[model samples]
Target: MSDQSALQAVIFDWAGTILDHGSRAPMGAFVKAFAAFGVNISIADARGPMGMAKRDHIRMVGQAPAVAASWEQKYGRPFGEADIDALFAAFEPLNVASVRDHADFIPGALETIAQLKARGLRIGATTGYTRPIMEELMPLAAARGYTPEITVCAGDLAAGRPSPLMMWHAMAQMGIWPAHTVVKVDDTLPGIGEGVAAGTWTVGVTLSGNMVGLSAEELAALPEAERSRLRAPAEAAMYAAGADIVIDSVADLPGAIERISASLKAGKRPGYR
Candidate 1:
């Protein structure tokens, strides 16, 4: 690797990228929270803004034309901050409880992280989860042998993913500067966008993320052709959203890092294309 191109750190997203295979927990919490207000949404809608801060995600969902119409019809007014607050109130405890159940590390995630750490790469993390949720999750993830050196959560900053503030925080805390010296790995488009905005090499994880939303068991059970069909849209979405690379899961992350390192050696920074 070119000396200047050597990676100093790798920042990962929490839920779908690390702990929760298929990113199942948050969607359920979002659905339940909305239903509590008598507005129903499909799983796809809930997943649409999956990488945003929980409250922002709820706000985005509520602002959807169809959801907004329903809210107006039901409550005689468009959804607003109050609605988002109420939904988030319902969402937090449910999400906190559900997180433990979904905390199983994605297959090979721990091993992949271990390998990266062994190479002297500082592992930092950025998450849409708030600190309290992360407090619950960190210990669970640690038990599984996968904990980043630094973790920047949603509310820790004034803005979250797609804004780059959280990623910046991670880099600052880890003492990794010059965004090109890092890689941001995540499973959602907004997360990828955050990496792009931060000027870090961005890798999008498919199969085990919001894009495909399949548990390890569920993905393994699919025939090769069907699995490809399911993953195509999500892969394309990530690429379209500016992911420099897309891998099947955290398992494929090492290879991506190798390739990104090569590109860096060739003097290609993120967004170079």
Candidate 2:
């Protein structure tokens, strides 16, 4: 294989991609944070902006048509930056507190990390989570043996996912270059878009991430057909978001990597039709 085709790094997203099955931490926090403002947001509403910076996420949620209507009716004003700030302030501590409780590693995460490390692949991470939130979750993840060489959080950069900046920062900090030589694994549309914008191959995980909203045990209890039925929309959305591949979880990542390696060897870029 040519050097250009040899993958060097894997940049993972936090929350859904690594810890937090169903990416439950932030969703609950988002719902409660909005509720605190007397504006109720459903889980689907919170999940809509899953992979962006928290402030951006809050802004998007506030600007959602239904949410905006509720905000106007309740407060007699349009949702604006001040509203975003207030919501974010409310969200911060709730997210920070909840992240620790949800920091259990996704199934196969440890094994995948070990395999990637064994293959000498560099490990780095990016997240929509802010530093304070990560500060709480990282130690717990570390205790479970899943520390990445670097973690780039939401506020660490001037911008976050779907912008390519955070992913670029993670790669730059790790001294890994030529973005195509890295693969990004994430579960959210913005997360996939980040990889695509960064010029790396992108893989999206559906069932284990926000798409299915089921824990490992919960998912295991479902029949295969039921699981597939639930996962279809996320899978389609991932492809629509320009993911090169989509899998049920990180458990299937190695096989996806093999397929991506073959494409790399064939001189294909991400999102190749």
Candidate 3:
């Protein structure tokens, strides 16, 4: 769209964008595991680090002594190796089952990606889920017939979202330069920030199954102004991380392209206010 040289690739985020995973699964799993250990945590507490790697998520939860203490006080049992092991074990099966059985491709996702690919744009994806999880889902995705040119998974790399590692790695593997030719789309602040830090054009998508992970009905019930607030966190985070623009959804992407192209055509620096 820009200098032709300025926009050669597009990187997408998985999870909420490509898959329709309801909040019930993760929230229920966390509550059950914490309950077994005699602790209680709200879904809000659990949502704080949605874009972090699995191990980091676990470590973050463990760092809260009060949460661990609540579990110990309730069950008269410590959150020792056994509890941690069981938690991880249960986490995989519960989530994988959903991916294998209940996974719904997001509305318009397949079509939008196909359209972008048809335009000769290189495509890739980055996810906070581990390599094993990705492996389990790949065949399913292949069966569904949507393939990304590259996929950067959690444990495959040393760090996760909020860090530019996964995105930078994906770009390198795809042979795309960050500054002149890439766009990154994501649903979370950390993921958006990662793309911005990598100096790629970053787009933020906001909707029901993200951030707070609200239900569609619940989201729809909210006033339009309240619903608009959903995109603020991503926009602020991306702007701080140096994003050029933040769009509300993937459907708005063509306009985003036009804006960036116009700027580049006008010889402005490749960023926005």
Candidate 4:
């Protein structure tokens, strides 16, 4: 819920926040892209830089120690821009194809957005995906009843997450104001960092995003203790990245927003600073 003295917009990160369940699309594409180059990366390698633009993500994975060693062994040299370019080229098409297959909305995502809108908060989104990938994804998501007022993609600005540029861009395009009046809901450290940088309230989503990395069915299959064991590291990482609040998924979003709105009314704001 919101008011004149409370929160304004709710900016979401696409994959884990609104859809894709476990943020599975890019991971498969990443693994396959690197494997195409004979690099043979694991899921961790594919996920370690989960919130970055795909090329930057590939670059980050290439710099991982195990990946570096593998690259040197295969290419007779270290990974560099040429390798990043090649890997990214391989990644994009596969990512687009993979996204086409995995755009299902996270449970409660549609309902959460509806609740926010009902409370007079606008819905916006940002993503680490490029335009081509988003171009393929938006229609599917829209058909499922998610049409955000604005969606800023990775390459929409000169910089993306952790830079605050995309957040600022989205706010500007949406004609909303005062960074602290907005809430950034995301599941990755870089995404949280962007909110922190932009002075917006940051909400980290644990289970539904890349950090927990399990599909809805898979996560539900885990015992509560095992689930906590898995969620510990991810939740800690979000707090470490300056999240103002953390919740299990968008299902808990209403409570989180209500808390933030109260904080705004109390003249408190994002506290990480």
- TM-scores vs. true structure, each candidate: 0.97, 0.97, 0.81, 0.97
lDDT of each: 0.89, 0.90, 0.68, 0.90
Candidate 1: deviation at residue 14, Å? 1.0
lDDT of 3 by residue, 1-273 (tens): 244445678888777656653333444555565555456776765665666676666555644677777767776876566666666666666566655653556656677777777778888999877777678777777788778988998878878887889989998898777454778877666777788777777776666345647654566578888867875775566566566776655656767776776675666544556
Model 1 TM-score on a 0 to 1 scale: 0.97
lDDT of 1 by residue, 157-270 (tens): 999878999998888777778889999999999899999999899999989998888888999999999988987988898899999998989999999999988899898888
Better of 2 and 3 by TM-score: 2
> Considering lDDT, which of the candidate structures 1 and 2 is the better prediction for this target?
2
lDDT, residue 153, model 2: 93
Model 4, which residues run further than 4 Å from truth?
A: 1-4
Residue pair clashes in candidate 3: 38-71
How many Å off is the CA of 132 in candidate 1? 1.4
* Model 3 spans with C-alpha error above 4 angstroms: 1-4, 21-28, 64-86, 216-226, 229-242, 268-271
lDDT of 2 at 75: 93
Record all residue pairs in model 1 with backbone atoms less than 3 Å apart, i.e. clashing.
none
Which residue window of length 10 is worst by lDDT in model 4? Answer: 1-10
